[model samples]
Target: MTDKTKPEVEPYDGGEPTELVTIDIEEGTGEAATAGATVDVHYLGVDFESGEEFDSSWSRGQSVNFPLKQLIAGWQEGIPGMKVGGRRQLIVPPALAYGPAGSGHRLSGRTLIFVIDLMGVS
Candidate 1:
């Protein structure tokens, strides 16, 4: 695996809930990702407000595989159209993320920011 540098992302300030936002840092080559495609990505996940990193595949030195449909609404919606080798920053509203129910202790009722590297698709 090739070592990828971590991409920078803007943190979400405290605010009203809104839509998912995606910023393309690097445009990738080949077909755009779509629903039902399995994607392999390296991602750094951070708290939207605090900018504290909570998870990262890049830190792990490997990518993770996931079926698009099974991911969170934010990922399911934002990850599509990203080509292989692309880099994107996603600001996910709480509604599109863990939602009201929230996830684990750290992410309860919190919005999320992710810098994602699209490594492969199948």
Candidate 2:
């Protein structure tokens, strides 16, 4: 894969997403991801309500590798069918993200936006 710069996540203003929303920004010709596969990716995340950045693999100067099944529900559902080298955006509601208002996770009850670059799938 070619070296890619960090992506910026645009604020979502179309109201809170009730479900997982996936938008492909750049398409890829490599293998597509599956729910059960492990993936290597670079991503940036921001709060939908505040447009504040929450996390970024690019800031750490490394891509992350993890099993899809272990990720948040939105990712499990959204990342599948996305090809390696592709860049995609996901708008995830609280339910599919960190859970409801009292779920204890810092991002609970918050809608989130993520720009993910698929680097590898295996």
Candidate 3:
């Protein structure tokens, strides 16, 4: 398994993100993602303020798979509104992310931003 922080981000030097934000970069024509659905996605994670890339599925050469219900709170909330083939940018607040405790050294007390491409759902 990959390290949790590998796909999240390094702890922000700044304070937490003030709110949750989602931007649809591309709208898809396929099924709308729903909770509990197994989804495949390609994502790039970065620091919202700095635009410093933290991780990318493209760099890894493969998409990742998981159930929407099992993802981080921000993803669980943001992704449900997306459809297969859609791409979205998510700006996650700390309360909806790793929170004050954080995920590990990289994501300690950090908010996060993710650009995700929905590939499939089952």
Per-candidate TM-scores read 0.87, 0.96, 0.79
TM-score ranking from best candidate downward: 2, 1, 3
lDDT assessment of candidate 1: 0.84
Candidate 1 pairs with clashing backbones: none
lDDT of 2 at 95: 92
lDDT of 2 by residue, 8-75 (tens): 77655577879898999999789999989999999999998888899999899899999999999999
Q: Is candidate 1 or candidate 3 better by lDDT?
A: 1
- Candidate 3 residue-wise lDDT at 85: 73
Residue pairs clashing in model 2 are none
Kindly indicate the candidate among 2 and 3 with the higher lDDT. Answer: 2
Q: Which ranges in model 2 have alpha carbons more than 4 Å from their true place?
A: none
- Candidate 2 TM-score over all chains jointly: 0.96
lDDT string for model 3 (23-83, tens) is 7877887898887888898898886666688779878988899988887889998998698
Candidate 2 worst ten-residue window by lDDT: 8-17
- Worst lDDT run of 10 residues, candidate 3, spans 1-10
Per residue, candidate 1 scores C-alpha lDDT tens digits across 19-112 of 8888898898967889889999999998877778899987887899999999989999999999988889888887888876436645767878
Candidate 3 is scored at a TM of 0.79
At residue 44, what lDDT does model 3 achieve?
Answer: 89
